[model samples]
Target: MKDVLMNERHMLSRRKMLGGAGAISAAVAAASVSKVAMAALPEPVIQTKPDTMPPLVPNTGRPYNPVVTLNGWTLPWRMNNGVKEFHLVAEPVVREMSPGFKAHLWGYNGQSPGPTIEVVEGDRVRLFVTNKLGELTSIHWHGQRLPNGMDGVTGLNQPGIPPGKTYVYEFVARRPGTFMYHPHADEMVQMAMGMMGFWITHPKGKHPLIDEVDRDFCFLLNAYDIDPGAATPKIMTMLDFNLWSWNSRIFPGIDPLVVRHMDKVRIRVGNLTMTNHPIHLHGHEFLITGTDGGPTPKSTRQYEVTADIAVGQMRQMDFLADEEGDWAFHCHKSHHTMNAMGHDVPTMIGVDHRGVAKQITKLIPDYMVMGERGMKDMTEMEMPLPDNTAAMMAGTGPFGAVGMGGMFSVVKVRKDQKRGDYSDPGWYQHPPGTVAYEFTGALPDPARFKADVSPGPGSMPSMAKPAQDVEVKVRKPAGGHSGH
Candidate 1:
């Protein structure tokens, strides 16, 4: 029976090759691939680097512009006769979140936040999902309009793909937009282990809604709750994920969005974590062009400096890279930019622990007093870290320490950057008198303004006048109870 299915698919594919696809029904490609020798699954392509790979231009399918996945790579698919086929293997892998830190996670292909899958609109897509893990898992095509049975819900739509078994998903790329893929089975543990990836369906032609840009980039927002010196995340952690990441990578690990000067750039960002993120870009303003549902209407578009991405939402922004300098791009949430933070540590601002440190050091020599001034000093000071742990803040800029960690990256818009080139152009070299300089002259007292008072009837004279220093003397009580 399975051999018959394989032979039928082979014949249908041959028909598709001979331009007989018009008569083929969707049900013909709905069945799982056969175990026959001719129905072998396409070999899965794996990427080992945690860097932004070049855009993967489709060579076998309909032509369309590709997107660069920051700190990730696109999954290469093989065209079987005519249908684009992709194979995804769910298994345990090690992902280096930053230079000095690596986490044990379960993901597709080879790394956490698995390689992105790009397809063209209106193309027939077939995915061979082979589960190599020790448990059941399924891939939910987030925000894709497909047959209800192919929705990938473990119980509602279909049963879970058991361990070491292969399940097939067949769908047509009906729309052109960005989406996410992750396990619907054991979501809390599997997703927390970083089992997720991005999917992009590009428009086949010059669609009216989609714009042409020089640089198109995509990444997913995720987080991990791993302890110091640990390689696995605490799956039960709900609200307190210590290590926030972009594509399972932290600052210093995340690559910059290098763009040519004045080039129109598009950045697609999706949030799969448990919280919302206000993604902010410096030195430029952008319009919210696309979302997970679809492209925003032109009349409804507005310019914004920061796009707030809610949980399970995708926001693609388009901007002109007019500024010719390295600009900071990061999450507006302060804590999200920190890595492996000590949440229970008390803030030591304005506390003089010098004498106490001396006494404590006598008992424990390695006890270091930190946060006395601010945590920024840790970026500059040489401090010891736990095994396989990244610092709270890392990275060095041209001048000094960048003092940033997770969910932080730079946008380097250089005048010398070339088209189709995503290489780092190094730090921007400012022209004469363009860079900010320190004042060596005498410093003057900062100017101050008095609080404004609104005009109202029957208001006191003191309220209307400028604020002046007032002195009041309090009489001591006759009993003199010593302020008890």
Candidate 2:
């Protein structure tokens, strides 16, 4: 049956090739190549370090710039194909220190979101596991390909890495990209307790587009749910778990992550926390070169200010640090920005239904009550405004022109001196009242603008002031806190 399917797919591909029009689908290609043949293909190799790639810039600190040892966790391999024999165990620790509240969490290794493992492209990764906890655990290489033994499926491929038994994962890093490793076993509980890390692979040599950049850095975004001190998860629903964070903590409140000006950082975005994060970076549009584990073609590539990082997906973005400052990076989901549900409030009032309902009443006027199960109860809920809405509204400045949507972060580029605010024609300046013209519709032709608008002097940062109040009110619904 498999042979017949492959032959049919091959014939179809040939026809499509001769037709010379539509794009070839991966499914069709996979069907054309037998699974056995694919398994036999040799892994791709990486040569020397790319000369074009820039060295990593050390952060501002006592050492001025240091090669810090990035910590990471090694999870046991989960078995697949119904063969559940091996067992893997690990107990990780997590903590929530936002909103002036300190709450401990459960994780696989020692951290909330495990540390990052950085390697140059083509390096073979020999993953070893040591079960530290009472429960069995395993890690599934989120997107990287490996041999059947290393696939980490609990039954068919191999047995689980039993507690106290070491499982060695050996695989060639065939692709240079961002990948994740997490426990696939009992995903609902294990992942919630935090069994994950960012696996970043770099190209062995410099590529044309990135060689000129000054530095490289990596960032991972992760979210978590907690039941206070318990090592297990308090699952709210099958799909909508309530915990939220980045690298496992809300932004701004967490230590400020920094980057130098003109440095090219390779941000490896991983969304493992069951929610899609609309990540937006301030100042520049990052080039998204890869997704999952493979290189994305030039046509489908994206260069955008805001991009969605779906749950269980990874996105690799290359951005030049043209702007410098304390850039704020966070999940676009408003709830994730706070320490916890109703977190911005004075106390730890977990998921206040009444407060939420009352706030909803203000944003959405007509409130209807659905007594029993039905669609009548559902109404359009209010949403948070765009992160850059204020900047855009402030009108036609260079920074103001870029609208926001993706998970947001800032890059502070160094400036020689401050140029006064306002669009002056002598330097790079748009004509007065041009801000309205930019967002309302198509941009005016550059030729129409006066030549004086060309670059002249540096300018001061025009901090955005949103006309509308940015505070998000949280009120419990008609019911009390007991609703959850």
Q: For candidate 2, write residues 1-484 as lDDT tens digits.
A: 0121121211211112112222222222332123222212111111111011122221211111111111222221222222111112255454442333333444533455554544545555555454445566667877786787677767656666554444546677776666877776666666665666666555667643333233334445655444333333565434434445455544322333344545655565777766578877766788877788566676777788877888788876778767644354656665454432322223233433566667788988665332223221222223332321111011112453222212233343443322211111222233466444445788786766677788767888669968987888766555333334
What clash pairs does model 1 have? none
**Could you give candidate 1's per-residue lDDT for residues 1-484 as a string of tens digits?**
1221221211211112112332222212432445322345565555666877787766677877888999888877777767788878788989999997899998987788888889988988888887778988999999999999889999999988876566789889999998999999999999999999999999988989889988899999999999989999999988878999999999889999999999999999999999899999998999999999989899999999999999999999999999889999999999999999756676687789999999999999888878999888888777778889899999999999999999999999988888888999888888899988999999999976656856558655663654876677555455332233
What does candidate 1 score in Cα RMSD to the true structure? 10.0
What residue runs in model 1 are displaced by over 4 Å at the alpha carbon?
1-38, 445-484
After aligning candidate 1 to the native by TM-score, how far in Å is the CA of 331 from where it should be? 0.2
* Candidate 1's TM-score: 0.86
Model 1: which ten-residue window has the lowest total lDDT? Answer: 9-18
State model 2's lDDT.
Answer: 0.46
How many clashes in candidate 1? 0
RMSD of each: 10.0, 20.5
